[model samples]
Target: MKIGVLTIGAELLNGARIDTNSNWISKTVIDHGGMVEFNISTKDNQSSIIKALDFLLDQSIDMIIMTGGLGPTHDDITAKTLFEYFDDIPILDEKYWNFLVSRFKKKGFKVSALNKTLALKPSNGKIIDNPIGTARGLHFSSNKKEIIALPGVPSEMKSMMREATLPMIKKISQKSIHSSILRTTGITESSLYEKLFSLIKQAPDVELAFLPSLFGVDLRTSSTDNDKFSNFLMQVKILLDEFIYSDKNLELEEVVVNLLNNHNLTVATAESCTGGLIGDRITNTSGASKVFKGGIIAYSNEIKINQLGVKKETIQKFGAVSIETASEMAAGVQKLFSTDIGISSTGIAGPLGGNKDKPVGLVYIAISINGVTTVYKNNFKSNRKNNKRITSQVALNLVRKELLKF
Candidate 1:
């Protein structure tokens, strides 16, 4: 089934608010074995909404999911527009009005005139209750196209989608879709696609999608039958095991924590330019205390020497961003925390910090695992925040690689 999504709001069109509804709807449709063929964003104007709806209907889409403009305020015109488009008169839904009144009364507040707008519904449309907010969703079936209108607020929209929209879609769409996602690191999207293109083509029933981010590349495979999809995913995993970091929906930090726990090992970190970000990532995972001992933020040369026990002479000779300082920091943290592994990062995440030889985005990462120390140097050209994020990702990837070697 092909689905069309329309996100409505002047704020969204003006970039005042991000349209996350489209992303949610897309993922939901894909997971339910439906495909999204068209997406549009429009302001909260009647003509604009009508135009978008006409265009989508002309495409002969099976379903249209619209988010926004279902509020009680004056700008909320989606319900009125749908009423006009269907040529249906607006009628007050007594049950919905009572529900709204009960909600306001429960909050120790009286229902105002503006709140009554939420009780208006198209004469021929069915009401989809919004449990989280005042505005109720409208379900209209006109011209053989199903339109599901939802509130603009993310929380209410998401709640209505999960509680009402998804079940209706599943009942109408008879296809059963199965999907699995494989997460990988230390490989580029092009390289990973090239390696798996032949296998993907051979399995025509299975649809493959590649999602790339700074952490890694995600491979999502979907098929009609559960058994076939499971078998295909197993085959793909066997073929790409070397490059696959996680096949069980685990993040990079979670994978590292599991590996360390399995080996009965503990880890500590000393960070400079990353500013405790590496430590933060590791500890963000649940049960991190089982493997994560602690970390130190050695941002200054004095702190690197005095706190992490980096040699003063080493920093004077090779600088803080050098391999020598990174290695020492790793080794010192490992000894201080009495952990089986230690990681360290020192970088120049730059808008200003750079030299002729050591330019901006110069990062040095070191990991000490089981008496072996490995250091890597990376030069990333991006904004300061992006550089820091990439540095943290690279550090985690390095630790993941080292753990795999065990």
Candidate 2:
């Protein structure tokens, strides 16, 4: 089935707010074995929305998922537009009105007359319950084409879709889909794409997509046939073995935690430029306490010397961003926490604070695992946030590599 997603909001068209609904709907539909042929974002104007709907209808799309303009305010015209589209009279749903009143009363607030507008629906449309918000969704069918209208608020729309809309769609069109995601780091998107281009082109039965973000790139493949999809995934896995960080939907932190747990090892961290971000990542995973002992934010030279016991002479000789300081920090944290592994990061991530030899984005990372210590230096070229993010990813990747070797 081909689905068309339409997001309605002046804010989205004006770039004031991103149209996240389209992305969510597309992913949901594709995961359900449906194809999203096109996606569009439009203003709250009636004529524009009508034209967009006409276009989609003309394209013979099987279904249309529209989000936005379902508030009680004056700008909320989606309900009215649907009425016009169906050529039906607008009627006040007394049950919905009483429910709204009850909700407001429960909140210890009197229901204003404006709130009554939310109870209005198209005469021929079926009301889809919204447990989270006032804007009740609508379902309209014409000539075997279905249109599902949802509120603009992300949380409300998501809840309604997941609880009500998705089930209906699945029942009407019983189909299954399978998808797999491969997480990778330590390589550029261009490099990865260049290497996988031929395989992707040859795999006509599978759909491939790349999602790039601050952490790394995620390669997603989807297919309608379950067994065929599994086989295709295995082929891709064999094609990219060492470069694939995760094959079972695990995040970098989760992978690191699992590795540590499997090896019966514990870890500690000493963070400087990342400001305990590395530690935060590790601890964010569930059950991290099993493998993570503790961490310290040795941001200053004094803290490095007094807390982590980094030698003053080493800092004086090689500076804070040097590998020598990073090595000492890792070793010190390992000793303090008495863990099997210690990780440390020291870098210059900034628009300032750099020298001729050690420029911004210069980071030194060290890992001490099983009495063996290794240090790496990276010179990244990006903004401060990007540098910090890349530093964290690299640190996690290094731990993953060591764990694999063991």
Candidate 3:
């Protein structure tokens, strides 16, 4: 089934907020074996909503999924506009209103008249359940086109989509679609394309999408032809095994933590330019406490010398952003924490503090494991934020690769 998405918010167009709903809806539709034909973002006004509705209805889409403006405020006009467009009158649902009253009462709050509006829906519309919020979604079938109106808040929309929208779409969709995403780091989009060009040409039925960001590239492969997809993916994996970190859409940090757990190892971090970002990423995963010993933010030479035990002579000789200092920091943290592995990152993440010999974005990442410390150097070309993020990613990737050796 083909679907069209309508995201209603003036804040999205004015750049005050991003339209994450549209992207989430599109991906969800695709994952559920339905295709998104187009997406239209409109202002939070009656005229814009009517125009957008008219345009989408004129298209050859099977259904429309809309989000935003379903609240108890003046700007929340989606429900009213939709009822008017369908030539329906608002009717109160007494059972839902009672539930709302009990819910508010349990929370020690009084239900205002404005909250009652949430229980009013179009006379002909079917109510879509929203377990997380007061704004209940509505489903209207008019002139053979199905419209599913949902609350704009991301959490509410996602809950409704999974609980109600996906089931509805499944009843109409006839095709079976499957997708797998392979996440890779230390490789550029162009390089991946060049390497996979022949494999891509060999499999014409599979759909391949290259999604790149500051961290890495995600290769999402989807197909309706299951046999052809399996064969093609097996070949791609064999060719790109070294660069591929995960085939289940897991983040690099998650991958590292999983590897550490699988091998029954522990790790600690000593961060410099990246601050505590590396440790933060590692701890973001669940069960990280089992494998993550601890971290030290050695931002200054004194801290590196006193806390992480980096020799002052090494810092004085080769500066802080050097392989020597990074190696010492990694070894020092490993010995201090008494972990199986220790990682460190020292760099000049800067829009400043650069020279001819030691330029901005110059970084040295080290990993100490089994009494051996290995260091890698990179000269990235990005602003401070990006440099810091990329350095952390690279450091995590190093940890991931090292864990694979065991």
Candidate 4:
């Protein structure tokens, strides 16, 4: 099945709001064995919407998934424009209008006249139910081409797509695009490509994609051939097992938490440059309390010395962002919280407060397990926010690697 996406909103074109709807629709379509032939965004005007629809039809796509401009407001002109494009008439859905009135009345509010627009549907179309919102999704088919119109609201669109749109596409989709995402950390995209290039060439049926972000690189291996897909995933595991944190798309923090749970151990954190971000990621996962004891934000030298028990002499000799201080902080947190594993991060995450010896984005991460402390030094080149975020990711990856040993 070949699909085209149309997102209609003035805010989308003017950069007031992002067109996340198109991206989500494309991904969902691709995941369910459909190909998104094109994605076009247009202003919330009848002329622009008509032009976009004409272009999508010209592409000869099997279906068009349109989002945005589906509401009670005057600018919400998708339904009216679509009816004109298809040369159809609006038919009021009396049953749905009564239901809406009853629903609003039960909530102690009267249904406004503007809301009646939601119950108006094209004469030649079928209504796609929206359980969460007042506006109903519309599906129109003519001359072997179909259009599925959904609300602009992300939550409402997602609910309708999952409940109705995807299942409808699945019935007619003859080709399945089999794909899997392999999550990895502590490796760069270029380096990972170099490692997997040979094997990738050997398997001509599989397509490998490198998606690199601030945290890590995600390896998306896809193949229409189901047999080849399984084999390619196995090859990736054998080659990049050390760097691969989760083959199931789980986050590094989730992986660390799972490992700690399996080993029946608890962990703690002592943070400086990254503040309490490391602890925040760990606790974001469900059941984190079982493995995460607590954390301390030792941002200042005074807090490091007083709260985490970092020796003042170590800070004086090696500086606060040095390996010695990081190691001491990790060990101090482990002892302070009586956890089996303790992690610490201390660095200069800044555009300022850096000098010749210690520049910006210079970070030191440490982990203490069973009284053995090991430190890692990393230099990242990015802004303050990214430096802090990447440092937190690195800290989590370090814990993941250590937990794997147990």
What C-alpha root-mean-square deviation, in Å, does candidate 1 show against the real structure? 2.3
The segments of candidate 4 whose C-alpha lies over 4 angstroms from its true place after superposition are 106-108
lDDT of 2 by residue, 1-406 (tens): 7788999999998889988888888777666557789898889989999999999988867888899987878888888898888897878889989988998999999999987778887778788889878888989998788999999999999999899877766766656668878987777788878888888787788888888877878888898877778877887788777778897768899999988999888999999988988889999998799999999999999999999999999999999999999999999999999999999999999878987899988999999976778999999864888888889889988999999988
Cα lDDT, all candidates: 0.87, 0.87, 0.92, 0.90
> Residues 1-406, candidate 1, lDDT per residue (tens digit)?
7789999999998889998989878877766657789999999999999999999999967899999998878888998899999888988878878988898899999999888778997778888988877788999997777999999888999899889888777777768778778998778899988888888877888888999987779898888878778878988898778778887779888888888888788999999999999889999998799999999999999999998899999999999999999999999899889999999999899977889888999999999876678899999885888888888888987888788878
Encode model 4's per-residue lDDT on 1-406: one tens digit a residue: 9999999899998889988898788767767877788999999999999998888888877899999888999999998888888888988889989999999999999899998899897787888899899988889986687899999999999999999989878888888889888998888999998999899889998888898998989988887899999988998999999999898889888888989999999999999999899999999998799999999999999999999999999999999999999999999999999999999999999888788899988999999999999999999874888998999998888888787777
* CA lDDT for candidate 3: 0.92
Q: What's the best-to-worst order under TM-score?
A: 3, 4, 2, 1
What lDDT score is found at residue 385 in candidate 4?
88
Candidate 2 vs candidate 4: the lDDT winner is 4
TM-score of each: 0.91, 0.94, 0.98, 0.96
Ten residues in sequence with the least summed lDDT for candidate 1? 26-35
Global local distance difference test of model 2: 0.87
Summarize candidate 3's per-residue lDDT along 115-189 as a digit string, tens digits: 778999777888898989989999999768899999999999999999999987888888877778899999999
Q: Compare the candidates by TM-score and give the number of the best one.
A: 3
Model 2 residue runs over 4 Å out of place are 225-227
Residue 297 C-alpha lDDT in model 4: 97
Model 3: residues >4 Å from true position, as ranges? none
> What are the per-model numbers of colliding residue pairs?
0, 0, 0, 0
Could you tell me the C-alpha RMSD of candidate 3 in Å? Answer: 1.2
